[model samples]
Target: MNSLYAMPGNEAFAELLSLHTGYQRRQLLLHHFPDSETLVRMAPPTPGGDAVIVCTLDRPDPKALPLMMAAATARELGAARVGLVAPYLAYMRQDKRFHPGEAISAKIFADWLGHTFDWLVTVDPHLHRYATLAEVYPNAAHVVHVASQLAVWIDAHVTMPLIVGPDQESAQWVTAVSNLLCAPSVVAHKERHGDRDVEILLPEMDKWRDHTPVLVDDIIASGETMVQTLRCLHARTSLPPVCVAVHGVFAEGALEGLLAEGAGLVVTSNSVITDTTQIDISKPVAEAMVSLCEANPTETARRTPA
Candidate 1:
């Protein structure tokens, strides 16, 4: 009798999750005031039944407050347990303080979310420094790996794909997808100058001349890394390359820029709900939610960070 509630901008994904989990679906209504405050409301959740919130935290700053409010409202409305399903979790990149007097945003954000919800589910979080989500998120957190999903898409669409990781951070994902497809793979070397500036050096691809290159990564924000990789790739090979990522957080016309920079195609999971989101991740996400629901929230709360 759990009810899945979709926050604004996440209705379609929630509906899909509802179908997959056999959970009744509802919308968490939001009204924004002129001063930019969001008022959250929803139908009273079933007593003793779990209340699940479906949201993808891409541009997370604006959405975070409303999400916290919704969780609090759900508790007041009588739900026995409240959980969050954020497919593309944000604020995971800043796991440590890089400079003097800098706040470790990743830990701060994780702590905030941990205090808000009883349990959480997400797709591949950017774990550059942290080993896992549980390292930061205090409450019970489950990660739904989408390697099989990405591999299935590549196997179905691409022919003789040479899976390529744009940088060392992407090596894990690239290896997973390639192993699943039984395809050759390579990882590129990236030197980031700034947030908007990056340099890419692709490994010699003379051996993969006949194979189609498929660049895989976890998130595509500015798309500069992918664009630079495409430039390096086109200089060495004649075949047009394809780009695949889990979260398509395209900023400042990045998707159009990629296509214009000679990318043949760009695809991502439905985590961010872009036009390029062709892969469905609802099944795995739903399964994770169900698994979390089966566990006692009180036991999970015991694992909270000190």
Candidate 2:
């Protein structure tokens, strides 16, 4: 008898997840004050059931306090356990302190979330530095990979897709999607001139010139890499390339920018609610949420050593 709660802006995905998990969907009523305080109100949780909060932490700064308050409210309402289903987790880019006096926000954020939720679930958190979520999160945490889902979208939408990675950082997941789709792939080298400027050096892709290029990446924040990649592809083929990604963190006209650069189609997982989110990842996330709610975190911690 797990109860699902949807935070603000996450109701649609939460409802889908509830349908998959067969859990009753609830809502957390939030009242914001002018002084920047929040009051979270939710119905009492079932006596022996887990209270799961579905909040996608994409733009995490404003949502952090409310999420903490919602979890605490659930616990105060006599829930047996509390968990979070954040489809797109943020604050994972800074996994290490690159310079002196820098704050490793990744670990700090993970620790804060670990303290708040008994169990956690997310989709494809930026695991560049930390090998796994377990390294930073202290409780049972699950990562829902969206590579197969990405492949499904690309295979169904694109014709004769030639999977392309924007840069070396994206090679791993891009390769996974390419292999899953059994499409030829190429990785490009990227030189960052500035925050929104990048130079893409693609290998000789004349062999794949005939096939429709499908540029793939995990997070499309600034979208400079994809834009640069599209520019490079312009020389190879006249056909408009398709762009697919897991999270579409379209920062200020990023989507329009890609379309303006000659992307035939842009698609992403529903990890973030945007018009380009054609792929629904709620089922896998629901499965992980159910598993996390059922398993005992203490036993899981014992089995997996520090």
Candidate 3:
């Protein structure tokens, strides 16, 4: 038995999972915990003979107590194993400490949570320098699930377009989509002056002047970088179609600000819930779960660690 716990912020995502996995509604447990006390009080009576799967968003200072309590409850109730399914993983951007006083949040967070679950799964974590999920979750079986649905959406919608990676970090994403569509791509270098302030420099568009350009990035924080890139493209000549980001963490009106800056459309995966756009990633995510399940049948049979 699988007991899926869907936190308040992940209802839509849970519904998507159910649709794809064919997991019965009764198997899914939905609860709203505004605070730690609420979370403790709302904990399921018992998670007997079931593997607990937790789903929650990235909280600024995540309340780990609740997650721990849930895991403990699962163990107490004879759960075989526990796991986490996070579409938008938090504390991943700060995978390293640039300064002496800075903290390696990604490692710290992963280590802390590693004790609670046997497996960790997320969609396109912001790995900046790290190449694989193992670098972050060394203890748990880490599964990095990408939002391949975005490529299909772009192929169907975007017409006569040139894919652009906002920065070198986004080159992998740009390359993946461009290869899928057999389209050309370009990478733009960016410089950040301050929060929500950035500059983008792209090569002369003598060759790309006629083709529509679509900028792609992993995350859109303040939309400053993308806005700057769009402005730069506009100055040279008529700008191309628009931009798209994998994780639309559009902080503080970033989406509206990007649209106002002449961005025709902004697309993103439903990794994080947003108003502008949300390409469903259910099929891909479900496929990943199936693969993981098949890889380790013993994973389903093993008893919870005492």
Candidate 4:
């Protein structure tokens, strides 16, 4: 019998998931009204069979309601288990209460997801404050590392490259990507004046002027970090740097701004579907969900801390 069906914006990933785990691909029928409300019409999983809902939560508030409905309906119709594959998980940044009235948004969001789904799988969530996904999520959570795929992309596209990070926060991520590429890495010093205002100081790269600079980041929201990096690089190297990010959430014309700042080519993994998402992580996500399904059906062990 056929296995799971993927949601909209996830058709490509469904095809790759099938290739990885032999799970059949089908669609979840959905639509938006003139007033911007969502509707879901999809076949539930067969009795004793499972379902996987693939939804990328980039612009999350609008997407969450329908996704929750889909999961609930699948179970109402007799699904044995339901799993969520959200590659670009949102609202994961605010781990603590910065202000007095602020909500522990990440923990609250995790509660909603934990109570709704039996298992979860995602890629490179903002983990600066949290140690692991399990800490935020109350169930089986899998995080897909994008460095391997990113390294492959660099090898195939960039020549004589120097991997670089825009600030100290990106040191671990940049080092991981550089190690995979077997390329030298640099982490520039940066001070955040405000959310969008940042000052950067780059190291002297006069000796490696021949190499192309490849700026690697986990997420790009305002693109200021990259713009500053490109500005510093222009004085030392003649070539435009190839920019790569795991999550390309180009808010406020980040894509155009990067190109305007002399970025050679901007690219990212399929974590967040953007014009620059050129790499795929379907195999790792599929493997994670399938393993959860194969684990003892009790669902108790999945709640254990990772």
Candidate 5:
């Protein structure tokens, strides 16, 4: 049996993963102390086959302790193998220390997960400086691309879609996705004044104003860029542009704010579980996990999710 364990926030995604791999759904009894210390309880046994932990690392601080406990406990409980499927991997943005005496969190987070789990599989992490996951993680690591899924979404929904990269960083993803959709793509120039304040300048759009602009990016953390870009799109076009992201790290009201800002569509992959987007990316995640487990089938405990 595949021992699949999931945090409370990840139960829905766990269900999807179980459906994909035909693994039994297991839940971890997660608790929080008054001082916010996390207390994790083993709700299911670590089966002999493979242990798969399905925890998308969004708002990850609180779940860190529980994940550590769960992984360690699974090892002690005789799991045949262990792996993690974190679709929306967090702490990947800060690869370097911009200021002195700051911790290189990306390296720390990578090492922590690398040490805890036998292997790691994620989808479209907010990778900035690092070229690949194997650079930081000593164990097996895999990344699932959702550009194909986003392309499928574009082909089914939008007509005459003009894919727009909100910033230069997003240009690569936008260009790749546009090629997948066989549509024209444009990259907007961005000037960041501060953490929350940003300015977006679009090039001449007289030829493509009628085309439905779809803003694409890897991650939408603060939603500042998307919101600002939405406002810019509203000023230029009569219809609101569709906003799509690989990881919907929509802080607080980012999704609602985008919709209220006259967004025609706001969708994200199943990498991050949210109410707005339901595009499934479980197939790739499952495949990555299966490959990871097959490679390292130690006498370990595997936690199947959901």
Candidate 6:
């Protein structure tokens, strides 16, 4: 497959991509845009007739401009199709509008991306109530890759662990991991008390007492939920060794707070790279990309050359 890399100011992550993809170092295009002028100045001079893989982490306002420009450049370079491997997809958590006049950011973002690329691949996207990425990006071939690597990582490190879901919505992920590890699983019912305060109702500790309880959740935004759950768990009985989360957004001291709450080790995937624990999910991400490429050969051909 013809591929081009667009760096997003993260050398370690780019190196990880190279290592996992076996793509040559030179093939990865590194861009350092300190400002909009720098970004527009360093835009790819010409598309290289290859699928551009944008690799970036989460930022308050991510540099999506570069990726969008790169997609346009690739199309101009004669690429039949373009695909995005954004480990941390933005605007996904807001798939729907809760208040009047509130825009469906997820759909709008997906539409914006669809206009630029033919397909998108992301890890553990915050689909919320959406069933699939296809539902979100109906016009584009979208692949929502799960963080199965989390289970593998947990298996390798956590023994006889109890999988704890931060909320009812996370039951699917928690159950899947529990079954895979042959461990018990419990879901915590959480109620938002205020902006950052939450109350958690954990399962009876009869079976979970003294066992390593690994809280599993898709996204840990402000970490209020996880922190509250951890506090409640500690109050009920002895806390577990660590907590395992899929997407460690860890927005605003979430990681530090979790660590402070006696969390042994907070494990997460490279989806949203964090300093704590980033178990690589590149293999699954690549697999999802390959599947999309295969399934949408016609679309791929239109955007990328054979």
Q: Which prediction has the highest TM-score against the true structure?
A: 1
Highest lDDT: which candidate?
1
Error of 6 at 98 (Å): 1.0
Total clashes for model 1: 0
Cα lDDT of model 2 by residue, 59-134, tens digit: 8899988999999889888877888999999999888888899999999998888788888899998888788888
Model 6 stretches astray by more than 4 angstroms: 10-36, 40-49, 140-147, 193-195, 294-296, 300-306
Relative to the true structure, how large is the alpha-carbon lDDT of every model? 0.91, 0.88, 0.68, 0.83, 0.81, 0.69
**How do the residues 170-226 of candidate 6 rate in per-residue lDDT, one tens digit apiece?**
888898888878888889898876768888888787756877888888877788888
Cα lDDT for residue 162, candidate 2: 92
Residues 1-306, candidate 1: write the lDDT tens digits: 898999888999999998898999866799989998889989888888889999899989889889989988898888888899999998998889898888899999988888888899999999988999989998899999998999999999999999999999999999999999999999999999999799998887788898999999999999999999998887676789999999999998899889999999999999999999999999999999999988976776634431
lDDT score, residue 303, model 5? Answer: 31
TM-score of each: 0.97, 0.95, 0.86, 0.93, 0.91, 0.86
Candidate 4 global TM-score: 0.93
* lDDT, residue 68, model 5: 84
Model 3 poorest 10 in a row by lDDT: 40-49
Q: Give each prediction's root-mean-square deviation over alpha carbons.
A: 1.6, 2.5, 3.3, 2.5, 3.6, 3.5
Model 4, C-alpha of 6: deviation from truth (Å): 2.6
Question: Per-residue alpha-carbon lDDT of model 3 for 1-306, expressed as tens digits?
Answer: 455566556677767776777653333333555653534323342344334354644553555665676666656656556666777777887887877989998888877667776666677778876777777774445454453566777888877678888778788888887888887888899886778777788876667677678888877878888888787777554655577776777788888888887888888887777775557875676656545534554643323343
Please give the distance, in angstroms, between residue 137's alpha carbon in candidate 3 and its true position after superposition. 0.6
**Window of ten residues with lowest summed lDDT in model 2:** 297-306
Better of 3 and 5 by TM-score: 5
| Runs in model 5 lying further than 4 Å from the true structure | 32-38, 43-48, 296-306
Model 5 quality (TM-score): 0.91
